[model samples]
Target: MDPLLILMLLAMGAFGGFAAGLLGIGGGMILVPFITMVLTARGVPETLVVHMAIATSLATIMFTSLSSVRAHHRHGAVLWRVVQLLAPGIVAGSMIGPWIGKQMDASTLAWFFGAFVAFSATQMLVNKKPAAARDLPGTGGMFAAGGLIGTLAGLVGAGGGFVSVPFMTWCGVRIHHAVATSAALGFPIALAGTVANVFYGWGEPGLPDYSLGFVYMPALLIIVAASVATAPLGARTAHKMPVRRLQKVFAVILYALAAYMFWRAA
Candidate 1:
């Protein structure tokens, strides 16, 4: 591997990790598109690029989420009850997400990813507050919401924060708590997504060396190492930033990433 490529992967991990901590995302929104770029440049088959990117991005979240949640826990911001309620559904949805993804062509999948990311960004940019009387739904409702969040996140290789954060806030959870809890949710999403992606992608032709199904081991290891290092820093920063400001900035970034995915699809 080229030293330059190594540096690029490391940098991606750092940025992704920071974003994860800062925004409660699993950093897949940032990592997926960029990973596509890297894999493309490395002469990976175009057909496999997006799938690998999504899989590798999700895998990294497994590590980044731990580092991020620890920081949030330190701040006493994590909502463990919420995590408990959502995890089961998230895992179930995550397991199926890759199977759906496997049925789609790469271009179609890219378009779907772009569309959802744009929607998520718009929601963040709008930053609408729900009615004061509104509150989190019952256990059944939460399971349904978690299932949806996990499915979409698995499809796009994200941490599910795009959906979870807004949903929590809409239900009257504070922005900080929402962010922390979302970070906590990333682990289950990543774990289930990773396993599913690997299974779905297993034995696919034209995979590069060091590949485990759709996951590129080299990229996964590098990104995880780098991301975990920076995640704590991002988590700390999230506490200091104004919620509205953070949302705006993150929204803009997501929009840019969405545009990139669209371009890739084209």
Candidate 2:
């Protein structure tokens, strides 16, 4: 990789790590678009750019989630019981998501990603509070919800925070707890998704050098190094920051990225 590209990846990792910790996201929302840009600029085939971006994004979350969740755990914000209940279904859904993604063409996947990002941004911009009387569902319902969140996260290369955070808040989980637990959940989602993506994308043609299935190894390694270093900082800030104001700003960014994805599809 060029020296400039390495610097760019490091910067991307720092921003993504901070965002992951601050938002209880896995940082995929930030990483995926930028990774797509990097891969596309490197002359990767359009057919493989999104796949590599999403897969590599998920792979990084496997590391970032650990860093972010450790900070959240220190703050006592993680709900371990909820993580236990949701994890099994999350793994199952994640295992199959890449197979589904493989069936879609690059444009279709880009469109799907664009729409998903737009929806998530809308939710963040609105910041709707769930009804006070609502509460988390039974174990079975939690599993089902986890399945949905994991599947979408796998498909979109996100940390499942966009869906999980909103769902948890709706179920009366405190916002901070929701974010923290969602961070904990990111590990399983990324692990399962990465495994599945590898299985599905292996032996496919048009992949660039240093590729591991759909993942680009160099980006993964460099990004993880920088992201882990910044994630704890972001997590600590989350305890003190005005997250509502931050979310609005982040939502606008997401909207812009969504527009970019649409343009990429076109």
Candidate 3:
């Protein structure tokens, strides 16, 4: 709620949003950690700040995803078939992640998050195997991928793109299309994750003010506004650069954040 913090968040949003759009990352990976700093600085109960940040970032992704997906769609990169195939699974898995997140301590969540982020980064650097492209399985495979992405999403409060993008790319979807379709998945991931987070934190004792469910609205609004404005810029830039380098760079940043989260969690 402090004026200075609001400005800082918006500024961070603009920068992170641009990178997210260009990279097909949901930005929550970065935003949640940044927000954890803010919430903790404001004298919030330390135990709850990380949870609130993750939950709130997931909520914001629902809105940011629409804009990023549109940009990717215009590039003719989004494969609707893929999004349709994976969505149902995402919804089912997301419904339960937040509840489980609530049951654990923030430190445990941070460790889980850090490890996951590091793993995703390594996958990016190594260019992991691709998935079946449009050759979606009848029922079992779809359910499996969706379940995995969704459950992790709920547990981590992510947009699920970290897993979804590579999986699709390996499956035979082109990189651009994989990223675009993964962007589309953010909406459902965020929505379902948001609902569960709210319920998870609803009436338990000891929470910060200006929270809706587990989200801090002030940070949410600033992040959404700035991310929306800059995502298109990132989308346009994504094509202009050597994506291999970009992936590595992003991976380093992820590692850096992962380290920071680990330290903080400790």
| Model 1 steric clash total | 0
Q: Summing lDDT over every window of 10 consecutive residues in candidate 3, give the lowest-scoring window.
A: 128-137
Candidate 3 at 243: error in angstroms?
2.2
Error of 1 at 141 (Å): 1.5
lDDT of 3 by residue, 1-266 (tens): 78889898998788667766877778878787888889888888878988998998888888788888888878888888777778888988998888778788989988888888888788878866665556556667987798789988878777888888777766677777777788888898888888888877887567777788798888888888998998887877775676787778888888898898898889
Candidate 3 regions exceeding 4 Å error are 129-134
What are the models' TM-scores?
Answer: 0.95, 0.97, 0.93
* Local lDDT at 40 for model 3: 88
Model 2 pairs in collision: none
TM-score for candidate 1: 0.95
How far in Å is the alpha carbon of 68 misplaced in model 2?
Answer: 0.5
Candidates in order: C-alpha RMSD to true structure: 1.4, 1.0, 1.8
Ranking by lDDT: 2, 1, 3
Candidate 2 vs 3: which has more TM-score = 2
* lDDT by residue for model 1 (128-182), tens: 7555457889999999999999998888899999889878988889989999999
Residue 213 of candidate 3: its Cα lDDT? 77
> If the candidates were sorted by their TM-score against the true structure, best first, what order would they fall in?
2, 1, 3
* Sliding window of 10 residues with minimal summed lDDT for model 2: 127-136
Give a tens-digit lDDT track for model 2, residues 23-117.
98898988899999999889999999998999999999999999999999999999999999999889988887777889999999999999999
Model with the higher lDDT, candidate 1 or 2? 2
